[model samples]
Target: MSTFLLEIGTEELPADFARLALPQLEQLVRRDLTEQRLSHGVVTTTSTPRRIALLVEGLPAAAADLEEERKGPPAGQAFKDGVPTPAAIGFAKRCGIAPEALELRDTPKGPFVFARVLERGRPTAAVLAEHIPQWIGALQGRRFMRWGEGESRFSRPVRWLVALLDATVISVTLQGSDPEVRAGNTSRGHRLLAESVTIPSAGAYAESLAAVGVQVDRAGRAAAIRSAVLEAAAALGARPDLPDDLFDELTDLVEAPLLIEGSVAEQSLGLPPEVLSTVMRAHQRYVPLYRSGAASDPLALDAKDALLPRFLCIGNGLPAASDTVRRGNERVLKARLADAEFFVQADRAVPSIDRRDQLARVTFAEGLGSLLDRVERIEWLTDVLLEQLQLGAATGDHARRAAHLCKHDLVSQMVGEFPELQGIIGGKYLLAEGEPRAVALAVLEHYLPRGAGDDLPSSDAGAVVALAERLELLLSIYAKGERPSGSSDPYALRRAGNGLLQILWERGWSLDLQALLRRATAHWSQLLPHFSVQAPALATELAEFLRQRLVSLLEEQGVDGDLVQAVAGEGVAIERVLSDPADARQRADLLAALRASGELAGVQAVVTRAARLAEKGSLDAARLSPAGVVDAALFEKPSEAAMLQVLEQLQPIAAGEGAARYGELARALAASRDTLAAFFDGDQSVMVMADEPAVRTNRLNLLGVLRNQASVLADFSRIAG
Candidate 1:
């Protein structure tokens, strides 16, 4: 066995692109080695802005030969008169065997001839040498570019390649201009600090890079960055705010990073702390420093007046130029802040109502009309949602106003310059213009939890508007005949769907997006007369789409898949797993837990059987008709009478509300198990399919009510057990 390494060097790549491509490169190499019949242990891949390297430990000295069974013509046909026919002879030749050696085997289609064929595996190096270059070329990027007149594509121009096995160089090119430099032990380090280092062997790759001021291990590099920034901020009596995303980018951006703390120009301190922090994060990709009180708790950005005039910077190279770097960066930020301050002052001079009018001319999407039209739809949808969810009346005025002005700031000069500040800037502007705090907060919260695990709207008004925005966009966009197809979600319907589900889950709102989408289509038809209206059909499709997301949300929380399926049973509008999302999840969790305790089988069986039988009848078509009605005059057996009594007792309890409703129903059903069991199986068993029509119909309807209404909380029909 030998240790292997492959280092791909390129012109300084974007931090995000490098981080994304490294894992891909590693996985590709591992897959290639596996397919080549090479035995190897752990595979490791790591990247810096300029390089992505892979290490495969304990790889085989040579590939292993594999044997496969090849089947041929039926034995009856192959051996007519016990002689090799042309088909039999050709098959044996293809398998590298003589026809006489073919063995007879019984298969589904009768007896067949089979042969053991050995496919010789090439030597490990021999196989890798032929495919490694193609493997490297197979790696993809966010966007590809062909550099310097070559046919090769990469995120950035390839510079050098180092590929080795133990002490020998692997025979593969990284696919670029350099052909003379065979893959070997040489690797470059820290662009302007260390020149180069010769790796002694694949195992020594990390140590060699570290000696030249580069940390190859991502965790070690990130730790060093955190320690440096924290220490620097502590010295200045400030705390550094290190968001994971930015920290990861910084780790990718530098081989030997240095932390630089700089002053924030006292004049700029008067600006909103968010303005300062935004400038640092979005434009500069630096962690922002915060001023903390005696307890070392960083003050909120909302504590505008108390913000300290200091910031942090991460320099990618030579620490000797830290002061120069800090001074240059400070000057750049000062100029940007001055521009921002000017925009803020100019923006505040105009009222939000005036800015709201500007949106009338801004297009939201191709066929979706203008931002002004979209806002009208959202405002209308917000009203409908609030009414549907039965949110308090006071939320209506604030949420409507917030919806009206949510996109107003996008037309502002400041937001135009800083696109990411759209929602945050809108809220700030609204507040400065003296809008109600509820309105301002709603405007800000509408874009809540922008991505996975992001915070949701905290206030009811915010949640209402947020839900309105996401629901309206989903319907309006789909109406334009542009659904998210594959990796290209040009419209982030997935994210919007996630936000919608999140709002429902968080507030336990029973607001149905299916109903909302149908209403939204009506709203859009009125607003954009020329737009094609995809109604009730899209509503069904969109509901199923969102339903899948609901299942995913529950599964993410560790609920079993069958449990989620069971809870979401029947189909589409017939049942909704998200009618009261939190409650639905609650029911799913409780039911799943009870079943896992091995206690629900008896009751679950009764529920499943009733549902299974009821489903075969018109109870679904006439679902509106009240079920479980029976002609007591037809009751002949005591067992049948007892079961009827149990059903009557459950009717009132099933109509109850609160967390205990489903639990109580479950207990009641479990309690009636023996009686129903006897009624179905006893010698005096009531014939559910009796010769008399009315009598048999009544019996089925009795069970129908149990499946259709009693177990409506969570469909037991869908439960796997």
Candidate 2:
């Protein structure tokens, strides 16, 4: 057994790329190793701003030796009158055996000639040489770069590579070049802290790197980052308020993490903290610290203490003094914050609502008019939502106001400077101006759940506004033919689509989806004169996106893909679906259960027919039989009577309980078992098809009852038992 080490080193990769590329490299390596049949042990991979490395420990030196048996033509058919046919001779040759050495085996298709192959193990180095390079080529990124006259491209240039098996080098070539690269008993430490270091063995990969200022394992790097940040904060009499997401990213950007504190200028403090931080992090990746509270007010200390201002800059090595880094970072922060403060003051000079109207002049898309037009669509959509959700006059009016004001922040200087804080800034500004609570809250919440696992809008007004925003974005993008294809969601319509579903499902409103779409189309048609797109195509594409959104939502809920296909077979009415995630779950569960029942599985088709007859036969149950008896005279046989009796018992409960139709059918089947057995045992078709019209009609009527019972549960015809 031996260990393997591989690293792809390049000129300092993008900080963002380091975080994403390392895990991908590790995953690709494991996949290749598994595909090669080289049984091994745990593989640890790491990445820094410059390199991706993988080490497979306790791996087998070669693939396992094995015997494989392949069956051939049947023994009897394989031979021609015992003289042996070409098939038998061919099988013998393929197996590297003589005809006499061939074996006979019984197979489902009678006897067959079998061949046993004893395969030899191949060297692990040979396996790696074939698979590693190919796997590396499969890495994914938003973009890749080709370098140095080599046809091969990656997220960045491939400067150097190390691939070693224990003490031996496993040479592999990729792209258009094969350089003198070797996997060795050596690796470089933090580029600034230490030069290349040698490892005595495979197991020493981690310790060797760490000894020279590198945390080779990602987890180790992340932990060191956290500890250093916390320690730096404590020393400054404050605690770090690192954004969880930003923290995760920083962890990935460094190998030997060194957290150093920096300060913001007192003059820059007037700029909104979010604006200042965004400018600092967006360009510098610096963690912004707030002012610490004094201990005199214990609770205040606890709260403001956490808000203390300090800069946590993860660097390659420890700096000489805090004053140097602090002064340098503060200089950059002051310049950026000054620009933001100017943008804010310039923006505030204009009235918020008047500025909002100017969004119409700002193109949201190439020909989609301005943000003002989108706001108009949202206003209309919000009104539709109010009616659809049946909100009263007060809530409806409040929601409309919220939708109208939601994008006001888009024109704000603060929002422009910190785009991520768009909604938050709007909400804050609205509150500052003493706006209604609903309107302020909606402005803040309208962009909720910006990503998967993000929090949803909590208030009714926010919910309405969020839905309007998403629907408008979807319509505008889809109308412009910028739809998502495969993994390329350039417009992020999928996320918007998924977000719309989350809102609808969480709200659980029974909406007339088709009617609303028709309304949306009509509204857009009137508004199209204000834009430059082909209105009809845009409307159609928008409708299609909504339809797909419904299908994805249902499919995600574990609805049978086929059932989703069938129901969406008609089209998804998001309102109807949202009225009940539970209903979809129940229907899917019932259909799935019915499918498993061999006897009741044909219910879909049977029920479809019964429903057709019920519609035509016009069986009126408006009045009960005063006599409390089903006409036994109408029953043609004991089976018919027994099935009728069970139907009579189950019908009321089925209709009243609203339990799934499948449960009723299951009960009907259970109750009528003896009757069905007797019917099948007897002449089931005795009166089923007869010269006597009366007898035939009665028998069909009995079949109708059985069919109707199952139809309510599921369309048995659709079920394939």
Candidate-wise lDDT, in order: 0.78, 0.67
- What TM-score would every model get versus the actual structure? 0.87, 0.73
Q: How large is the C-alpha RMSD of every model relative to the true structure?
A: 4.3, 7.5
Model 1: lDDT equals 0.78
Q: Which lDDT tens digits does candidate 1 get at residues 1-721?
A: 8888888878888878866777787778777787878888988888877888888898887888889998898897788798998989999999998898899989889999999988887877777678767766888778778777667777887777887888787777554553333676789988776678898888899999988878888768888988988898788787677788888888888888788877778878767677778888888876777776723212222434545677777787687889899999989988888898998888888888898999999999998878998898888888888778776667888888899898899889888888877888889878877888888888988999798888999888999999888888888887787888779998899889888888877887766555666676666666666765656676776777777777778888788877787776445243355455566677887887788777688988877777777665555432312334676788878877777787777777776677677888777887888887877786866767778878777777777776755555566766675
Colliding pairs, model 1: 566-718
Question: Which run of 10 residues does model 1 get worst, by summed lDDT?
Answer: 294-303
lDDT for each residue of candidate 2 in 1-721, tens digit (9 for 90 to 100): 7898877776667657766766787787777777667788887777776777888887787888878988888888678787678888988888887887677888777888888888777898898887777767877776788776667777877766767788777776565743434445556777767778877666667787779887878777888888888777777766465777777778767776766677666555555555666776776788766556633211110122333445778865555655676677778767777787787677667766886787876777777778888888899899888887886777777788888888888877777667887887677666656777777778788898798788898888888889888878876665555768899987788888788777766776555555666667666666664555565566556656666776777777666676654444333344434344334445556655555665443334434444454443323423222123345676556676765666676566555544345466565555556554554356652445556766556555555555555434444444332
Q: Model 1 off-target regions past 4 Å?
A: 65-121, 173-181, 230-239, 291-308, 389-393, 512-517, 534-542, 569-586, 596-599, 615-628, 656-660, 681-695
| Cα error, candidate 1, residue 264 (Å) | 2.0
**Distance from true location, Cα of 636 in model 1, Å:** 4.0
